[model samples]
Target: MRVAVFSFPGWGHLRPLLPLVRELLDRGHEVSVVVAERFAAAAADTGARVLTYPSRFPAPVPEVRTAEDLAQVVVAYYEEAFAALPAAWAAFADDPPDLVVEDALSTAASGLVADRAGCPVVRAFPGFAGNDEVPLNGSEPEPGSPDLDAEHPAIAAFVRGLPDRLARLGVGEDAVARVRARPPRANLVFVPAAFQPRVECFDGSFAFVGPQPPADPPPTGWSPPADGSPVVLVSLGTSSNDNPGFFLACGEAFAGTGWRVVMTTAGHLDGATAAAMPPEVELHAWLDHHAVLPHAAVVVCQAGAGSLMDAFGHGVPVVVVPQQPDARVMARHVAALGLGRCLEGPVSGADVRDAVLAVAADAGVAAAVAALRSAIGSAGGAARAADVVERVAAATPTDGGSQSAWR
Candidate 1:
């Protein structure tokens, strides 16, 4: 099988899909990855053939500072992405993919590619939010906050009509209808299923995929935390890592606690600030967080699904400080699952210490972490996901002059 994987530009979106790409390829299928141009080589490192696409926006769109900003950037991104379909179609058709895997926000192409090339498109949601219903993130505006008006109404409507759009590109209207009719695109949720009880709202078309196969190391070198004390990994996440004050606050929180801190400032933070750490804390542009999270005793992090999922996959407890729209939802899930505590907004050192201490000292919290880990193992999510994808592919027979294939 020739499989094509697509994620928007963000690290949060790309990281989860990485392991599955490897899984498919390891199972003896040809895989191609479509990602932002900057992330092309990163995907290539995993041994999949890489294809590049122009992102709707240029790099550095700024941090996910507020709900409004979240609404604005995401809305604009999908709007521009929808408009770019013609070019994207041309690029993919030049070398057609047998199967297309898509990240949460990459909906239009899912219907388009499957329609145009007669392939199966697997919709993967990176966050805990499984679909349009039981929203992992905010589907509707918060009660008190200014309503997040979907500014891109034109594209929003266009996305709703995606099946018809794909039909024009040769995906039969009924076939395209079947694809869109499945809520949230036959999604596979990468987070723990116990933490997510309401996924049924995605209409049984979706199934939990568990975490992507365990992440692997990049063929590059970056120093791991060398501090002597039990290591604590602190990261605000890929897009929200720009807060200098947050890092300074974390420094204060861990002071004298004897916990050597490893903070991945994600290149947005200044090295000088990290250099000034009070003897124990080590700060750097980025770390192989997936590599480090397993070794750390506790993770003090943004409620990025990528960051927390990596921590949970290793049975590590979390101290969540959510900074974005999705982070808030993720934090709630973390607390609900008993793995750790959630802290929103500008987190203080004292709060960080308290959450970390709570996770460390309380046997109950440790049990919660263990329980989550056990639940995932019981579910067999990765295998289940692979089965779902293959089953879906098999359901739609192709008569384009070739025998059917399976993994």
Candidate 2:
């Protein structure tokens, strides 16, 4: 069988998709991963054919000073991603694929050709909120409840722009009509089914594929102390580490403590930022997450699903400081599930140590982590996902125009 996988630019988005792709390759299917010119080599690590497209997105402007700025940043991601679709199709002119597995956030699979090729398209939801329409981050003054305002600035922009973007994609004025009329063959959600406990509804073509990490974790450049001074990993994810003040605060908090802190400041920070004389701080641009999770006593991060899920699988407690919409929602679940702790606002390193210890000290937290890990282990994960792909490839009917969400 021939399979084509499409991934977005960021590591969070790319990470979850890799395990599933690698599973397909292990099953002996011919696979090709379509990615940006910058990420082709990274995608090729799975041993599949790497198909590159010229990505127009700038080095992710991860610093969100306000709601309006985040709105603009998101729109830019879509525009650049949208412009690359036709070219992606042209790259596959010779032998069209049997199936296309794509990032749920990307609309590339909607290009008229892939459907015309009579192939099934399955979307992989890597972050929080899979295919749901209702926002899950309602933990504040409740946009519908109390602590938060009744406004979602980011979602509103995309909703308003939907008509214009659809027209630009040649979906016509009735694009929303088409969305209502035609969804996709199936959606393969990569997170566990229990994380989202919501009252609202969404398109129902989604599946759960559990949490999966690369079979091989990377080797870290630094090692923990032999004396075992509780090691904690402090990361703001790769993109969100643009804020220097946050790192400064962490530097102050983790200083002079028995805890050994390995900080991934990302490429956004300068070396001078670490000059505050904290001999215990180890800073680097990136760490091979798969390589380091086993030794981690706790993880402090931005609450993205990839990091949270990895920690959960390893029975490592987490301290979540969400930086975006889904991040906040996911953090709520981490706390509610008793698997970790949640920090509501801007975080300090003192807050990091306290939260990490607070969550790690609870014996029930360890039990919950072990329980959830057991649940995830039975999710039929990568092997089941491979089975579904093979089944779809065999059953795909010729002639694609309009169909049900589940084909």
> What TM-score would each prediction reach against the true structure?
0.81, 0.81
The alpha-carbon lDDT assigned to residue 292 of candidate 1 equals: 70
Clashing pairs in 1: 129-136, 253-349
- As a whole number from 0 to 100, the lDDT of residue 112 in candidate 2 is 39
The stretch of ten residues in a row with the least summed lDDT in candidate 1 is: 398-407
RMSD of 2: 5.0
| TM-score, prediction 1 | 0.81
After TM-score superposition, the amount by which residue 390's alpha carbon in candidate 1 deviates from its true location, in angstroms, is 2.3
Clashes of 2: 9
Give every collision pair in model 2.
140-147, 140-148, 141-146, 141-147, 141-148, 142-145, 142-146, 142-147, 142-148
